[model samples]
Target chain A: MLNVGKIEEGFVLDHIKAGKSLSIYHHLQLDKLDCTVAIIKNARSSKMERKDIIKVECDVNMLNLDILGFIDHTITVNVIKDGKIVEKKQLSLPKEIKNVIRCKNPRCITSIEQGLPHIFVLTDPQKEVYRCKYCEEKCRQRW
Target chain B: MRHLMSPLDFTTRELEQLFDLANDMEQHRERYAHICEGKKLATCFYEPSTRTRLSFEAAMLNLGGQVLGFSDASSSSAAKGESVSDTIRVISCYADICAMRHPKEGAPMVAAGRSSIPVINAGDGGHQHPTQTLTDLLTIRSLKGRLSDLTIGLCGDLKFGRTVHSLIHALVRYENIRFLFISPEELRMPSYMTEMLREKGIAYEEVIRLEDCIDSLDLLYMTRVQRERFFNEEDYVRLKDFYLLDKEKLSLAKDDMLILHPLPRVNEISVEVDDDPRAVYFRQAQYGVYIRMALICTLLGLTGEEGGNIC
Candidate 1:
């Protein structure tokens, strides 16, 4: 039942983890933008219990998908036009996501100075573990 | 396709394809720079592994591609208890491919299952390190000229050394390969691998002394014996140096034999051994990249001649 004011055309990101709105904000470089955007943190969600929301007033390509990573699968993206959703899509991880996440293994040759651009090809989507291109270490999300 | 969830997933032919591609990439370096151009590689590391993380970044850059991702889980959404699946589902939109590292076993497999792109398993707990196996294959192919019919000795903490297990698993596919396992009795190769060796019907020998057959080995793989693996500190001190290979030990080794180690050495190998011609651990590190380059290329759907993948 949560709603935001209509925009000419844009996207609405829903079901994000609570209080992680800032990371997504930075990832999209929203601060540098001149367009109007709204970040709703600590919102009540029937699906997530507690979640964050993002409303982008400007047209953007797949930026909501990037934010979904910092949040969970509870994310829903609504494509709006004339103040109504024309499309709604749920995101999924690509088998080979580029430069969107970092490998966690420090001993990985990729982590070394002068190392190549670290490439992680995800092997398991359910577990979220990736392999290092150089060291061959299976990397995971490290907080 | 891109995700490497398990070592078992790589068919022999797939591994060969990776090797062949790596060889080609090494030979014709500049031509393939744009193979993955405009593509992005996202590395989502949930732990503190500097080496593995950077290697993925470097591989992407070498291919004339761009890179992005978070090094720390805290810096990313994972710090807030976000599920790995949800995170990747979202990252999939931004990146063409991804690599992830986690502490939990079988985590990468989960990520790969949900992803639309290919997944590459970097490492998963003490379970498997397939890419390291690729590095080993490249190293063996380079130094030994082939992988078959060699006396391969695995020394040090065999029980917990993921590399040793993966390498052993990989080498079993070759003909007439003999395994010489040298380790403290407490740290002998684990039962699972031992059973696997038995099931595969590969010949092997167990020993505590490094000198017994140093001259007979075609390859010597040394691993660290972490103090955490031992109960008494004195036992560690006694057994730790029991296997150290100095110049004296190398003197008995065959001139053609190569000494390899999964490194970050803690005095088990004498610094003087660095000058020895047989030392190839540093080369081992370099092979890590070339193998990765091949893996990235193949996983990203760039085809090479005679190419096929494991299930």
Candidate 2:
């Protein structure tokens, strides 16, 4: 049994799709924060069969949560307060995002200018598809 | 007030309205002579172009508007590494409307984001040419007298032809649009595009030979397989002559079938076919100017809701 301390006043990212915790870990820049982070990989789950979980010892902002949602909306964010689950959030795709991921299309103007911030709008929420605002190229999420 | 960056920018209803406006401009040319008087249009070509630039300038000038701006990237501040955003912002201060062509795809899109005025995408690499799509649509509507229930054959470089891609995206909105994609195995339409067609439930067929399908087509849209698109010189040399349309091929096509091209044609279309009554590429080029005139007037808010009463 691996023993990890519970988050007393922070977020618990639960039910991340298996094999995506490392990317979520780096994408959220969890290492830069002066806080204890426990990333439990391949945790057995009834819903997902296999999942990843991250319990942070510090309260993270909504931007970080949105980033997590963008990565994998199947994630369940549990806000812990006073050593208890105070609020549980079912992540949904964001309506708009800025500078999170670069447009990978080489011909896209964003690729050449290098100075402009990449912006994507959620065109089809059913498919979890985000389209680049300028080029209109569909942005595929890389997990 | 919206910029024309992609074919998807305008809805089907909007396109029909635009086509009607173009019709009015064609019938009553002198009535719309000075509709855009004192208005300025900027032709910002970040790539070398002959027809698209001239068509836009001619459109603006025919509407009694002045034209300005560079024809090539080397002449513009883009040579000094000026961003598309900055260039558009600066041009917006001078021109009432701007038409830009860039070798980089979506460059006009970036310009549209920063410009205060309407931005028209003349051509954006191999990504999109919305105005050209509009011209094609208008041509089809006028010539065929309708926009639905017809088979359109897209021949030659389906891979890199932005016009073909945009036209497909547009026509799929109509009823019974059967697409016949004719190209060599290597130059076939992109799988992603075919996937989109499948997802939309649009019927399409792909063939290596034009002879197999050309006779059944209501329209044959021929495209130049550019040597510039190929990384390997050998592949370019091999594929360049793979889909050439000559008098022999046209004999198999329908008598009333429209043969169109987004011109400045290479050897893909033989000059001998120009005299053929079925060849409507020149007429298609003429319609390009009128459609653009309608676009400029509408974007500048010179026309009414019905797109009438320019004079």
Candidate 3:
């Protein structure tokens, strides 16, 4: 069995759908952070059969997990401290997300307006539907 | 400051107050004439909707306010690649309130986000036209004496009719309102709309022919059926006549039944029907002015007798 060392601080993202860790990594903007990070792809899991895990060694406050819940709330977020799991953080859909996704509707004002932030607002929590703030066009869930 | 982006932006009670103010304005136009005397209205039209632009201009003029701004994107700073946000910020300094019409959906919303003064969405591409919806409500209320407990038959191009969709969204707030959607199968109301009505527990029936439910409707709203909407020319030719509202079709409706169409219509409604007392689309345009006047007053906080307090 291959083994990876645990981080004394920061987060351990677990049970991400297999191969989606890179997307989460980019979405969380981990590449922009100066920290030690490890991405485990297609890890065997009894719960999910195949999963991905990402461990980051940095201050807990450095990570912005707002987009995590929107990406996939099923993925578990564990806060690590002193080489042990400190707390499991819960994730919920955000009311609004900015520049996360672009509105694809050609008639949308964002298509022509300069420097307008592409914003998606969560209209239906149960259905997991996000619509563009400008045009109210439903965002196609790519994730 | 508040901006009118959608009809649902205002609650049922607020709409009632606005309608009441409109009714008061209709009854006593002279009393509210100079309410906005020193105020200036900037009409920023990114598209050429002469009817809507004129209605807005007339509404401002009726309110004793000055009117300014561009009628087309080419004439405005937008021609020089100026953003809606920047144009509205500049307009905010020049006018106390602004009404905008854009070919792009939600352009006014972008402007409203950055605007210092109140903004009213005149019409945005195929999106919400709140003032038009307000005018329909006011016209229905004025002529029929009520907004609820009526069967409204919306005919013609239901799929792409922004007015029809907006009217449905606005009318669903009233009690005992039933919808009769009349359209060709090719241009039927979108599933999302029917699903919304179903979810809200509102009663609605979709029929292919206008005559199937014409007699039962208390109000019939008509929209143009475009030739481009169909997959082929044959279907457009075959279904075009079915949607046209003529005197013969008007005979099928109740004597007191009101007919409405968002104006600048192209042959969907016969010019012969214009003389019919039941055909109130022209009067509906007049109500457009009153509703807009009331809206400008409400948004500019001129609803109070002293003109400083909001309603």
DockQ, structure candidate 1: 0.02
User: Could you tell me every candidate's TM-score relative to the true structure?
Assistant: 0.65, 0.94, 0.95
Could you give the interface RMSD of each candidate, to one decimal?
11.1, 1.7, 0.6
Q: B1-311, model 1: which lDDT tens digit per residue?
A: 55676555678787777777787777877867777787888888877667777777877888877888888768988777677677778888999888887765556666776787676767655666677778888988877888798999999988878889888988898899999999989788988678778878998899989999898899999998877556689877776765788999989999999989877778779999987889999888778878877777778776444443211
What ranges in model 3 sit over 4 Å off?
Answer: B226-242, B304-311
lDDT of 3 at B289: 97
TM-score of 1: 0.65
Question: Compared with the true structure, what per-residue lDDT tens digits does model 2 show for residues B1-311?
Answer: 78888877888998888899899889888878888999999999999988899999999999999999999999999999999999999999999999999988778878887899999998888778888999999999999999999999999999877789889999999999999999988888999799899999999999988889999999999998887788899999988888789999899999999999998788988899999999999999999999999999888988734445455
Please provide, for model 3 over A69-124, each residue's C-alpha lDDT reduced to its tens digit, 9 standing for 90 to 100: 88988879899999999899988888889988789999899999989999999998
Candidate 2 regions off by >4 Å? Answer: A42-50, A60-63, A123-127, A136-141, B304-309
Model 2 has a DockQ score of: 0.67
Per the 3 Å backbone cut-off, how many clashing residue pairs does candidate 1 have? 120
What is the Å distance of residue B15 in model 1 from its true position? 1.7
| Best-to-worst ranking by lDDT | 3, 2, 1
- Which lDDT value does model 1 have at B139? 88
* Native-to-model Cα distance after best TM-score fit, residue B38 in candidate 3, in Å: 1.7
